[model samples]
Target: MFIKDYISKDYPAFNASDSIEVANEVAKEFGYSHVFIKKKGFYLGALSQQFLEESAEGTLATLEHHYEKFALLDDGNILDSIKLFHTFNSNVVPIINKLEKYQGYLSCDDVFCEFAKYPLFSENGALLIVQINNRSYSMTDVCRIVESNNGKIYGCYISAFIEDDVQITLKISSENLSSIDETFERYGYNVVLKYYDDEKEELLKDRFGFFQKYMEF
Candidate 1:
């Protein structure tokens, strides 16, 4: 999804002439660590809670030295937003238009929710990690082998590409992976790791439950 689609315009923004007290109140009301600052419809920067609480008295423009300017353009996608969040260690990020006008802010929670909905993460399937020489790598053959064993591939992605080989991670709809694993090995593919709900149902159940609980928090 695009950043503009997920950004929330409901959040507040402060003017350069606004006071720290005003920014602090807005941040508290919105449960945000920082609030955006703008002047004459132009994006200025942000004011952090720490800066507002410690400053004696000053306008947002005067006391904005502590805040960093980080934002993504409207054309950027979810992956771009995620990278900025991790790079800056921020829970919320701003979005801007092509003209550099502030659009809105995106929260990490919302981005993560979108990510969890991806087929790679949302599907309940068997995961297999395999290594094969780059020269002999053929996704068609992999699919053929799995299909011959009555298995359906939910999704697959390349994990790594070394000098002479590549590592691939496949998500299969079938839980019974013994025959599939043997079949892959027979075709000269090395199975590095295999994960299926059938063999580790209890472990997966506990972990998934913990993840759900954590997300709720």
Candidate 2:
């Protein structure tokens, strides 16, 4: 789970005194938009690819004014990479220790691959998206609502916030999909979406219910 496990040294960190050409070569070679610069075994910051292309010739230290400051600690989880990836718009994210020593980096691809291994993404199940007031939600209540209806929740996360309400997305496995939907509504949850699989099973259930009602008469 720690970021250090996936740290890649594929892209080398540059010393500030290193030549602009050396940094440019590495940046272009790896197709990275930013290059990590270091001095005395500690990371200074990063200089964007655009800055290197514009400067005619100088040491990497000369481009100090153009450095962008951002990095993940080696101990941070891979999930932390998503925010940095969006904020910096970098193809690869740098990793550093608490002392600010440069560790390595994980590319955007690496982060995605790691995320794909999690049950929330990798598991096979239907997705239910429901909206409820902020004060109306709790993990226990949500889990109870799903499980009481004979559904098992694989995982759940807040999908969005609307005014004082929050929308939650849960990956769940269930045979009685309609029962789960009905249960959520009975509990005051606004079911925005129920992306269940196995339509044939649902159709069979409906037919069986019709037969039962007919026999009752």
Output the number of the TM-score-best candidate.
2
Clashes of 1: 0
The estimated TM-scores of all candidates read 0.74, 0.84
Model 1 per-residue lDDT tens digits across residues 2-55: 777798899877788888888888787777767788777767777667668888
Candidate 1 lDDT score relative to the true structure? 0.82
Error of 1 at 91 (Å): 1.5
- Poorest stretch of ten by lDDT in candidate 2: 193-202
Estimate the Cα RMSD of every predicted model relative to the unseen true structure.
7.3, 7.2
Candidate 2 deviant stretches above 4 angstroms = 197-217
Instruction: Quantify all predictions' global Cα lDDT against the true fold.
Output: 0.82, 0.87
lDDT of 1 at 35: 79
